[model samples]
Target chain A: MKLTILFGGASFEHEISIVSAITLKEKLAGFDLKFVFCDSDHTFYLIEPAKMKAVTFSKGAYKKMPLLTLAQGSFVQKSMFSKIQHNNIVLNLIHGADGEDGTIAALFDFYSVKYIGPRVDACIFSYDKRYTKYLCEAIGVKYVKYEIIHKNEHCNITIPYPFIVKPASLGSSIGVSVVKDESELDYALDVAFEFDDTLIVEPFLEGVKEYNLAGYYANGTMHYSIVEEPKKEEFLDFEKKYMDFSRSEQVLQADVSEELTLRLKTNFEKVYQGLFEGALIRCDFFVFNNEVLLNEINPIPGSMANYLFEDFTASLEELASSLPHSKRPKVTYDYIHSISQAKGK
Target chain B: MKLTILFGGASFEHEISIVSAITLKEKLAGFDLKFVFCDSDHTFYLIEPAKMKAVTFSKGAYKKMPLLTLAQGSFVQKSMFSKIQHNNIVLNLIHGADGEDGTIAALFDFYSVKYIGPRVDACIFSYDKRYTKYLCEAIGVKYVKYEIIHKNEHCNITIPYPFIVKPASLGSSIGVSVVKDESELDYALDVAFEFDDTLIVEPFLEGVKEYNLAGYYANGTMHYSIVEEPKKEEFLDFEKKYMDFSRSEQVLQADVSEELTLRLKTNFEKVYQGLFEGALIRCDFFVFNNEVLLNEINPIPGSMANYLFEDFTASLEELASSLPHSKRPKVTYDYIHSISQAKGK
Candidate 1:
């Protein structure tokens, strides 16, 4: 099947998405790959695969390419009397808002475009931190205790002095702040509220062991990736995360006991089973007091989390083939026909 | 404001949506109205306001109208050199799947189109019955006891003998069955599974007092319609709901004690606050044993539930003006620029 790499959304992570698309162009060289760029303005453009470089986008040269419009089930470039349709299955490579937050997923479903990514409901569950907490509660998965605060609400800091403040709907730590004391609380909340109207605040645990696992379900079975314990200081802030998103080399797997591994994998599967289908996602976990606590879900992980897998390309192909089919209700219009018959129209 | 009525989705309730559009064209007669029809094939067409009748869609004559494409922030009809843009704020009148199931809302939000309907998260919470149950749990609202059964799973009748079986994701009564005994269970499960992969089963209560309340939040306050007590038999089947969707006359207010009315209104507010913003939604509740239990949420109700309101057009205008603006994270490429400067690029 032809694969179209969709990148660059109207998101704060637009540049990061460009980096991911460029990295994929090198990794997935054996596939019939096509590149489509969505500008921050939400317009689509078809770019040459040879031009898949960070400089090509950073220099604003992609705008000179063919302008495309999303039609019924494909992207089309139109002339006076003819239109060229690109009907390849889209690999949603945009990292944040429009891609992982259910905007593009919904648009693609509405137009009947087949794509490899989270569906609308999955995006809804994973995109917002508050919803993720509720999902963990519903599925019996342990998550860090957090309280949500909306903008303009009273600053009731019940969690404690040292806490983590994050924008509820953002990815990549764009507006995350670790408050060390009471003096830093207002600054952290103001920064977070700049990114989102809602903020989720959780108690900051010192020296938490963080493990990242990436995988996808395909061919009637789950494919697991080696978990990596990311080596970072305190937390990954925006600059460190910007550098982290561009990494493509495989890292050393986390060294842990079999029992701990089983526990982590069990919690991961519980989170991924029914909610995440047709998408390769990464879930970060915090292991504290011999319990696995889900941190957050990366619905569209950077570089597709290719570094975590042993054979990413083969697994992607299997996932593409085993994508869930939308259960479209058979619209026979029988009721309308019966109504028309009753009216004698 | 120019209001565009979008009807006819690729859903089982496509006919009901057409009836809703036709009814709105009559009740909202004083407003500047335009009609757009989405055929079951997922193609869009522009129809004349005078042709907003069930016969126009039932006979497939809408296919002959001007073909339209959804461009950025508006719907457009294109010719050789130029395109005519219909920049009206769309009133999402399409019921069921594409309308109430977060498809159209996500598409509209992606393309920056101004619309009056449930946002994506709200649609996610209200469209599926299982998710609605989770939502009730999150918000501390009272809902009926239920069990979810997936297709191909063991047929476990954990609930009592007499219960209502419903397709989890479908709206209206298309794939709903009331099984009075074990013999009727298989047929009900089969019918419900044909419509959706998941089914939500709830115990059937005899002589349950059902009440429907419709409302929308706008201009810093909640505006509620008169609570309606629908007069029906055992349950509203497809044929009964078919006749119900086309009613344009105002429904009579339910006569109940002030205390009971307050309880219903309080539950409705809890469900609608922060979740069903920017859309007029109807909540159906069952008062059993003096406790109000939420049955389901109609995110995009038939005829916008205008029959329940005192001044439907004015409330609609207020909602249109007070629609929630998406919190777009400022995409300043500061991080990228800083990285580039550090590398001396």
Candidate 2:
């Protein structure tokens, strides 16, 4: 089996994907790995494994190689003879537009290639904050009150002051801002618009502790990890998350009563059943006064969310091996031909 | 400006798309058209213009020509080394999975090509019945009560008898069955499962008149056509819709009240605003006892839904010309490079 790690996409989260890729390579060391790099311009490359350690967006770290593209239902080298066929699975690591938002997955689906993670539709639904909010609302889950703003529409700030403004489809807090007052709304909107045409503004929770659980689907069953609370000053901003070295020091198992745990578990199950059943999802919730408000769901969570699970490498190996691998189903066009022949002279 | 008509697809609606393509060629006769045919097996062909008239699934009607594939960020003819560059817009006519469900459009997006339809994310949401239902629910719209069943889960028949069973993601009623009793449920489930892994079972709306309207986004504004009610013996099944030539006689402009028209317009605006704001959407509604219930939204309707509009050709021309045509934005990797340069030492 040819397992390819696809990382670095056309998104603001490009650098973060590199960090995640480095960690993934270390964790999945037992497997024979092939690497495919998607550049920020959406070009794909089949990288040399010997130079994998030096690959980066930095001036001299990367080397341009033969391009890889899907042509006539087969993945092939651009020079036109070499094919990357034979039982391959893509371990997707692209985080934004072409990655987590379903574009890459959809491309893979178009070619009938197996890619690890959510189906294309699920990724599209989960990546967009507005759609996620709508999904939560439809499932009767409580979420932070938010207003969806389209790019061409005039700014309407119906939600009161001290709200968080975010691009609807970005990950890793790329274009997120905590707006303190009405005066700060336009600036926040501008920042978010740079990332995506759609934006979501939600009333900021003042003193709520953020609890998150990472879960995966294995052999038709959903397995969830123990909840952890990230101790941050406010929200985890981009700088504090990636640049600051002291970020993961205080990720403690969330302290809650058994009744609360039961409620959380039940809600998590409902969410998974309703929306993110096939892929590994990292769900974040705000808990204050025993009320849990669903914040967001990440379809391709960071580091494939390994840290959340005990025996992370072993569990991932099991999940990876269990993927239903097969060649693209040979579509029986016979039915179509039969119908056409019966109808047309 | 070069305009291409992309038709047929790797979907159950492949034949329907061919029919649509023939009609679209007549409807869009004024434009200089390039033709691309997607076979049922998902291979793309750049057919010679003179040979496009013979393109069909009928025995010996279709001819496979130069293979068109996206390479180095542009659509190209693989054998001839010819580039399909310079001011090209795809009038997408693919009706189902690889077409309307966003996979092909996402591929176009990946290559930064312009296509005349909804954006990829919008198409993904609108094509899937389950997601459309969830979006309607989130927006407080009245929809048929439905239960989603995933593959590998225990089959639960919670919806009352005389319900509709449908594959969650297929279009044109490909895998839809109206079950009148419990005995017919298993066969319906089997039929639905053959199409998709996810299924939606909804309580059937009895004694309801089905009204449909075609609309599109033009010049940043949504344009809607008058509602047309199809006089069907029962629900419009796949055979009656396509195989029966007498299907077009009974489509009448709905004899609705002024108040009903206003309500329909309002609801249509809300639905478009809340969900689809990109391409043309054909909305189906059930009207009975002065109540309106959304049935489903078709992202890529047949003949691009020209018959529903008053000045069909004029309206379609306007919408096509008003598409937001721009090159794919060049991504700036300077920030990523700067971060890598600072940290990767």
Candidate 3:
């Protein structure tokens, strides 16, 4: 099967996607891998997998990677490799914006390409932090108190102090800041506005422990991985970038109480079912005083959430094999189509 | 200016969109018009404007429309026209699903093409009836009482006996049924399920008058068209489709009381600003017992809502000219880029 690994998107988390793609390539070695590198400007580049892997985070090494463009639905390079080839499945590892935010997924759908990820509507639904909060509230899930601030609006801290400010649509905590006091509020708002016109300000959950659960849906049932807790400071400040972020800080099968774990898992499944489809997603939660509050829903998490599941390679192989049968829910307007045709006639 | 009128999308409302494009083409005659016809299969075709207008909704005429495929960044025909050309602007007239639901908007964004419509997040937020209700609830806008019914769940009628069952994401009146009692529940559910996995049941607003307000955003302010009330039966049933629906039944600048008109305009502006950014949108409302309630938000309404405005052609000309300046809010994460680069080094 021809499996295309798509990475490097027009998102702030571009490097993270590249890292995730590298990890996926190594894990899914059994399949024929094709690489599609999406530039920050949204241009498609068909990169050589070996050359893409060899890049050592240096400007010179990046320049040497083979790049190709799409011509008639095929990935094409001008000189030697002049033809384009279609993929049986596109394992999209591109994080944020064009990739995880439904742009690329929609493009794949336009080409009738089978890709492993959530549908366009699902991706767009959860892309905004404000929308996610509304979804959580609708599902009766406990969430932190929040307020949406528009860029043109005056700076009035209606919510209490010591709250975190975030760009509404960004992922991987790119433009996020914890306003410790009134003095830091202005700077935080300024920083947040630089990333998005719409900002979400939520009160900092005191004594909150961050826990993540990765899950996927297959054959009409939801499956989940063991929950992992990331040992971090009270707040994940914007200054503490995600690039240098290490998985070593996470405690696999976290030593949380059984009751709390059960609640987290249950809520995770509920959110996954409500807001997502097709993709393997990671749901982050804040556990405090026996309450599980959903922090974020990562539709395309770092590494496609390969680290969370046990036997990542086996799980991926199973997922890839099931891609042909794992269909996304599509609306069939058979009645409407006929009605429309009759009206046209 | 080079303007491409995109229509006939992969949606239940495909025929309506073609009608809308035909109107747009006639209204905006001053601009250089190019028609990009998107079939139900998502294949794009470049049809001559005169040929497109000549077609009387006939299957033979549609079959003869020039079909084209994308080659790199350009639309290409197989023989005689193999090169690609870019349009200065894309007037997206496609309604529902891949069109109005944000799929094509995201695709246009991916290709850095400026198109007339709301962005992905806003479209998805309003596309889902349940989410739109939540947003209205959050913003303190009065709305009809509704209950969400997920697939695989037992058929439970929580709302009142006289209620409407509708697919959450569909536009127009497709897969929508008015259930007056228990006997009609199963048939309504079956019809609704044919369109989507999730369905919404809302109480049938008794003695409600349907009013619609179409508007667009320009230079940081929302502009409006005349309010029109469609004269229809109590329920806009599936049998009474929108295609055969007549605009002649509508009372232009509806003669509602001044107080009611004020409320409608105010609510319209609030919903427009809160829920949408770009494009001319039509907000549907139900006025019952002096209470104004939001019914639906049509991101890409039929005829581009040309009939609502007093000077339809002038509005199109002005809107088309201002497309370059009428920008959507975007995030600029300057800090994250530098941080990512430094971390990579």
Candidate 4:
């Protein structure tokens, strides 16, 4: 089976997606890899593995590649009398809006393209910060108290001072702000509203221990990765997060009590089961007051969060083989035929 | 501007979508109309307006038409060096899974195609019955009390006998059952689970007054349709709902108290305010104990719910013109370029 890396989208995290794609080319060297780049203009191009470099995309040279169009279950390069089809299972590597935000998932599902990524509903739950809160509430998981504030409405800071504000539907800390007091609220709101129409505000807890766990469910069992406490100062802003995607080395696992680890794994399992089928995902949690609170869900994590798992390649293969297949109902058009015959049309 | 009617999908409601497409061809007769048919295999075809008949599709004649492919912002028929591009704004007329379940919305959005339909987030909220409950809870709207039951889990009828069992993610009455007694519970679960993995069970309210209202937000204001009290004996099953989509004549407005109408409109507004911005949607409500309880949200109503509005064509035109445009973020990739330069790659 061939693996197609689909990366780059019309998103704020487009560059980071490129970095992730290039990194994957090295990590998945053993596999028969095919590279497909979605430009910022949303055009699909078939890029050669040799040309899968950061500068190739940064210099806008990838456009000269063969243009690809999506058809039922395949990507095709159209010719005069026929088309060349690349019937490879796609690895959705695009991040942020078009990748993590149900766009790519929907597109693939509609076209019947087999892909290894978060399904549409999973993306809906994880992509939006507000929806994540609702997801937590539904699953009986704990999350930080946050209030949704839509743009063009009266802005009210009900979450108290020294809080964190983030655009509800964005990733990679693009439009996130740490507001200290009333003086910084307006500027932060302005920055966030530029990225999204709605915002999620939560209390900025100082000295909170944050842990990251990535996993996927396959072969009738849930496979988990070692939980790593992400090292950071205050928070990793957009630039720092962008740089972090380039790291390929495995990080040290977090040293925590077995009970706390079990709690984190349990919460992660609750979020992953049923909702996040067919994809590997990372959940960041904050241990506040001896309770695990979900911070965010990375549906399509950076570099697929390969460093977290001991055998990333083997895990991906298992996930790909055991991806949930949508049951196709028999569409005989029997009802329509009866209706037409009854009407004598 | 040219108007393209995209109908039929890999959904149970595919035939109904064809009926809706043919209905729209007549409804928007004054406009320059084009017909695009998505077969049950998820293949797109360009059908001539003259062949937009029920028999043409039921006989599988649409497969012989010109095959189309989707690209950036347009549908095209590719040749050796040039392609015929149909850069028309699309009217998403497909119903049920692939249509209303965020699939087509994400496809169109990712391709930058201009369309008049519910966006991705709106589809997510309205597509699944369980998610609809969460949406109502977030907005403080009243919905019927229910519990979700997964197919693999123990079949526990916690909602009592004489309840309604529905596939959580399916539209129409495809996999729905009205369980009147304990004996009917297993059969209902079996039927619903065949269509979807999860089921939402709610108390079957007898003699409930159900009202239907269709509307859209356009030109900085909300335009409502005449509230319709559908004439039904018990509930619309699959076959009854199937024939109902073929009705093109205007439905009569319900004769109710002005106070009741105001309450319905207010609740409808609350549901549609921010979530559903561009598309015309219909919300079914049950007036139980003088309170309006949301029954279901039809994101892409059949035949665009033309019978409810006085001037459906004019309303669609206004909505098409005033559709919310996604703000494209500037992708400078300046950060990536700086890092590359520093690393001397």
Candidate 5:
């Protein structure tokens, strides 16, 4: 079966996506593969699968791939991509903004292409922190209390001295700042306006424990790996995230205490569903005052979260080995068509 | 300024969109026009704005139209849409699924293109019924207790009889069915699944008074319109919606009581910001036992809700006059350079 890989979107996490895609492609290279990379310039290229490990776009037209656009699920190049046919499995390695969120999935749905990951609704629900909190409340999943502030509006109401500010719909910790007082609000707001109009002001959970989860949800049941405690602050600042890993205190794999692990795993699954009635998700949670409150859910976690799962000794390939060996069921258009007929009937 | 008349989409409401677009184009013909149409096959054409009124295709070469891909929002054929230069307004006329939701809005946001209606986050929140109910709850608006059923998941228990099941993310009451007994649950599930995999089951309010809202949130306050009563039995259906005049038993405008109208107007504006944070929205409410409970929020209401706002004496053109004026105040980024800087910085 033909499979296409889409990576490196117009998000702050674009380069890291290149690393993740190269890692995933290297793992899956023995199979028949067509590698496609999406760049920041709103275009895509079909590169040689072997060249994914190193830079090939050094010179010549093939080096710098022509721009590709998505019409539904199929990718269209104005000149080059228009000539290539679509693949059966379109693995999305794109992250942040349109890639990590449901926007890309919506295009996939439009093309009637079978893709790997969560549905559009769930993908969208998790990308934005505003709706993510609203949903967490509905499903009874514990999460931080946050107020969404629109820049066009004004409010000076203080939520204590320290609070985490984020551009509501962004990921990879872009434009996220931990504000200490009223004096810093303007700078934070200006930084936020660069990414999104809506801002999520969340009460900082002080002196809390934080953990990361890589989860798999297929056929309605949610599965996850052992939670890992990050050696970072409750909120990872942009500098700590990318430029300076030393800024983060340290990351330690917590002991899988039976009771605590069970509770954390259960809540992680519920939070996953809350974000979007999705098929797969990766969740982050903070444990404060003996309570595990969800932080965020990543629907299109990098290269299907190979790092988090493998680090926990639950490798994706191992999971793939144990699973029932069957191709992903071909989506049925008849199911969608019958409803159209029902409208007339 | 140049304008792109974006119409047609891959939604169940595709045909209805065609009808709406043709009507909108006929009325808006006096403006500079770029008629870009999306066919059922998902092919897009950019014709002479005037000639796009009817469904006409030229000799097999995708004539007079650019093969434009909606994702990332750029045209494949520059000559076809080169007429649509920078910073032009896009009068979005599509509805249902991705079109009605914020997926397209996010794309519009990526390129800094301003369109008519709410931002991506608000549009997405309003689309999901489950989330909309929570928005109502947050703003102190009432709602019936509702539970969701997963696709193909067995009936754990027939939700108490006399309940209504609807596809969670739809408008125009397309897949709504009132089930009175356990026997009807399967049929209802079968019907609802035709539209969506996730289904919402709410105990029906047998005698609730229904009210429809058509208002824009200019400066975060909603203007009023006399509510209209539908001429249908127990529940509103699709047939009554698209062709109401002939099928209705009785259709009349309801008089808003003085004290309650004042309360509703205040609360309506309150809820517009609280429940649906958008520039414009159409909400549905059910008043049970003299208490109004928000049932749903429509981010992109059909035909821009022309008929509901008709009695107010504002011509459709006047309703649309606000399109060009809405601007997304944002910072200009040297995007390519930013990609390089974002990676390094």
Candidate 6:
């Protein structure tokens, strides 16, 4: 099957996206594949009949392609996608559009392509912090109180000093800052503006413990995940999360009361299904003073959070087979079938 | 200041975008304008300043530009945007991306560009249905029972049959459908998916009438506006509300009791400040059984719903000027200046 995996958006999380894409491809090796990727530096690659072999583009000069920027000039018209072989399903493996949000997914809709991910509305909702927070509240899940700092406007920074300032749409803590005082608010806003325009300023949880939950949905059945207490040094940001060696620690599970774990599972599923398509989501939350506060839902998690599911022993193969393969046969009989069905045929 | 008016996205409302861009241009004649547009097709256009001619390449097009096929090597990248004149605000004249949603505004944050719209979180919450309904419920506002259809799942369309389906992320009545029978559910979903993947299905309200309240925020003050009754053939769809001749039956100053109207206005302003930051929003609701069920909020209404102020005989110029234009320039300078100061420039 000629299924294509789109990854590595124009986000700060580009390199990690590469890791995620490669891992996803390896897991899906049983199917014929096409590797679609782009990087932060803007280098892009598409692997036809994707494999471990090295690929080079060298007609005149050697260079790679970037996915976000399609070809310029002549072919940049409406008919561009019309000629491409659409797969049975498109699995979005990238994040941070820095939450480029729903553009790629929307493009899939524009092409009438069948894709496996949250719909554009869900993607849009999942991408923005403010909306995600409300969805959590709607479903009776706990989340922190967040005040929005509008673009080009003063935030009043009055939500008590020691607050967290970060880009609302970004994940992986790309443009996150802990503002301890009035002096730091300006710097926090400046750094955050680098990643996203809108900022969510929420009171810092005094003693926060972070946990991650992963869910997979296949044909209307939801598999609530075991929550993992991330084993990390301090708080990890972009470099710490992706640069591998920089990570002081990483953990797949933590021991907790069965009831609390079940609650986490229930909360994660409620937030996932209550707000978006019951597909796959990596729901993150924080526990402060024994109260769980929703952080956000990642519609498409990095590397599909391959590390998170190890505790359940759900091998990549098992997970891959559980969901329908998006790959398609190189040759299609649709056109011929249509022709034969015609009156004159 | 060298500024761009980024408009015309790959949305069902693309044509109305053209009108919005042209109108913005007609009003922004005094500014140094750079026209950035997403065409009727997939092409992104950079209208040259000299003759207002469409240019083949854009600054950041390099990242966005790629050869149609990987076999066709060394795809030219439209990577010009990295060098756009510094400190320019993008007059995001586009809608559905909602302009106010964090993504485009986050672009402003990335480039330090000033923009006009509701705050990012406000935009996020306002445009989302699940959250909007929750906020309404939180504040004692009435709404209909709704269920979210997770992406591509089967349901007994019978329960919600006689239901209205709408795209979550999209504003305006585009990609909306009413299903009266079980057989129509799939067709309704097929149409709803055209605009967005997330479909919001609610029991269609068949009570009384439809009303829109034009709201604005200036000097941190929320202002109530006259309630407008949309004179249309049906609930707002792109063709019904945005088409060139769709306003032939435009209704203004919808006749209702003063006491009821005053209560709506008071409650609307309260909800607006608490749930949204209004650059401007068109609040739509259904008047059924002597009760008002707040339907949703359009943070970025088509043409900014300028027609709502028709009774005041306010010229487009007067209404447009009332918007935060001058404040934007100062806000732009403040952010840049703050960044410079933080950088020890």
Q: Each prediction's Cα lDDT score?
A: 0.88, 0.72, 0.72, 0.89, 0.62, 0.58
Q: After superposition, how far is residue B1 of candidate 6 from its true place, in Å?
A: 22
- For B1-345, candidate 5 gives per-residue lDDT tens digits of 345666666666654554555555554445566766665565667766546533342123335455654433444344533644334456666666546766556566555455666665566667778767767666666777898888867766455889999988877787899999888888988999888778899988777777777676444235555566544377666655544311212124567677665655655676666434434566677777887777777666655555565432243334345442323222122332454466674
lDDT of 6 at B272: 78
Best model per lDDT? 4
Candidate 3, number of clashes:
0
Docking class of 1: medium
Could you tell which candidate, 2 or 6, scores higher by lDDT? 2
Residue pairs with backbone overlap in model 1: none
Candidate 4 lDDT tens digits, A126-157: 99989998889878999999988999999877
Model 1 C-alpha lDDT per residue in residues A1-345, reported as the tens digit of each score: 479999999888998998888888888989999999998888899999989877677778999999888877899987777899999999999888899889999888887888999999999999998899888888899999998899987878689868999999889998999999988888898899888888999999887899999888998888888989988688777777888788888887899878877888888899898779999999999998877999999999999999898888887888899888876666666787887789887
lDDT of 6 by residue, B118-209 (tens): 55555556766766787777556788778876566765433445788887766667678888887887888888776565778888765558
TM-score of each: 0.97, 0.89, 0.89, 0.96, 0.78, 0.58
Best by TM-score: 1
True contacts kept of 4: 0.73
User: Of 4 and 5, which scores higher on lDDT?
Assistant: 4
- Greater lDDT among 2 and 5 belongs to 2
Collision pairs in model 4: none
Q: What's the DockQ for every one of the candidates?
A: 0.72, 0.45, 0.38, 0.72, 0.22, 0.09
Looking at model 3 chain B, report the run of 10 residues with the lowest lDDT sum. Answer: B324-333
* Weakest ten-residue segment in model 5 chain B by summed lDDT: B242-251
Please write out the lDDT profile of model 3 over residues B13-78, one tens digit for every residue. 666666667766766677788988877656677877787652433353555656765533455566
Between candidates 2 and 4, which one is better according to lDDT? 4
State the lDDT at B205 in candidate 4. Answer: 88
Candidate 4 has a DockQ of 0.72
Over A274-311, each residue of candidate 6 has an lDDT whose tens digit, in order, gives 44553467888888888877888888776666556643
Candidate 1 regions off by >4 Å? A79-82, B80-82
Worst 10 residues of 4 chain A by lDDT: A326-335
